[model samples]
Target: MNSPLTIGVFDSGFGGLTVLRALLPLIPGARYLYLGDTARLPYGSKSRETIARYALSSGRFLLEQGAEHLVVACNTATALALEDLKADLPIPVTGVIAPGAAAAQAVGAAGHVLVLATTATVQSGAYTRALEARGLAATEKACPLLVPLVEEGWLEATPETIAVTAEVLRIYLAEAMAEAPQATSLLLGCTHYPLLKPLIEETLRRLDYPLRLIDSADATAQAVAGQIGTRAAVGVATSTAFYATDSIEKFQRLGSRFLGQVLPPVSLIDLGG
Candidate 1:
């Protein structure tokens, strides 16, 4: 019998679990190997060379685990090191940026496409370039706090936590809208932001901002499905392996929030800083 298809996903931290969550339904019956380089995370603050080196290491580790294709699920890694990864890795590679921009373009987001991403991703201008390359105007907002709020399990834990997160979303949305009043699409450029989608929609409604939301995680999953085709659906059951460079307990604990399901046993691995 043929072996099950294996797809590898790499992220600086467990935020990429959101991408994996998006992939579960779209590309069922495939083995997933996910690596969260938690030890050396915050890839956003690192230099380009350092980020590329880290990404390549993570990609190669997944390939060694029998991954046939790789997904760079972190926006910072995708923005900084996707090209390097594609060039060095033998397997097909996908990132969260281009697919998102294409998704926005497909929805006829022509006048202005607002991007909500990490400060590093915004500084890289990756989303802006991708959107404009497709003839869509791009406006990127650096939402640095959203990641922490999501990671902290503040999405609706309590009235106080929910209010804090909602207020932050309200402030960010208000600021972003002030800059791109004509924005027709608001792209969630960070993987962690998917957890806040409902709240974001609600906040948008509260603020009377009607920009369509574009989730990069879902878009990337669809792109992966399109690339791998139906062969990925051959197996009877889908399996996933989780790995983290540091803090296996923390990875499993916080990762479930992003993945929207209980995570299985996670292995600890070291890739060296």
Candidate 2:
């Protein structure tokens, strides 16, 4: 393949932009198409069948836009619907969970590993399964509030928002620490969590929880780079496109926070219920 690659990234909402942000630096030569299924988000509340149906539709839509490779950036989708998408989507696909678990194993070295993710992702026990496969002991806590706070742009907002977010993290991490007393690493199992890494690390310090933080978004981007070697020409501009199933206005407004740059105009596309 002499030409640049076109990779499609899908998420339930804006959090996936963290994955795309990580990808830009690692694989900048390639074109990127990101779709956030905003209409039917919070996939954690849905059943497995519903998740698979929604994810399949998004994957097919990306392929329709000429995506040669795919990245499943949403933790809930990766936990519940990855296999379904893999079986049906022909492109080489990667997800955040496996790389995240592997990252834990590599860093934890048999020490207890703790994961902070969405309620649906934790319920699926995907991280537990992946970590255990590598002979690592794992504890997962569903900090359901983290995703919402991240999406709301509260991480760096006003004093009240900052304090509230910090308090929430303190509560979740404290509870998780009590359960996984020996846990030595904290995997930011949600893509959005990466944005709060500094706050999380500070909170861990305050609580004396000596766990290294690993952002799965970064891990996934590294995996993608390994699979698709650096191919950007020395001086060619990269192409990026954004789409959402609902609320294009919100996607563009909140998405800039995830992408670290003003998002290009995001087009609205329906993937159906």
Estimated TM-score for each candidate: 0.97, 0.97
- List the candidate 1 regions with Cα displacement exceeding 4 Å: 233-235
Clash tally, candidates in order = 0, 0
**Per-residue CA lDDT of candidate 2, range 1-273, in tens?**
357789999999999999999899898778899999999998888999999999999999999999999999999999999999999988998999999888777775456789999888999999999988999888999998988888887888899999999999999999999899988888888988988999999999999887888889999998888898887755666889999999999999999988899998999998878
lDDT of 1: 0.93
Tens digits of per-residue lDDT, candidate 1, 151-211, equal 8888878999999999999999999999989998999999989989999999999899988
**Model 1 vs. true fold: TM:** 0.97
CA lDDT of every candidate = 0.93, 0.90
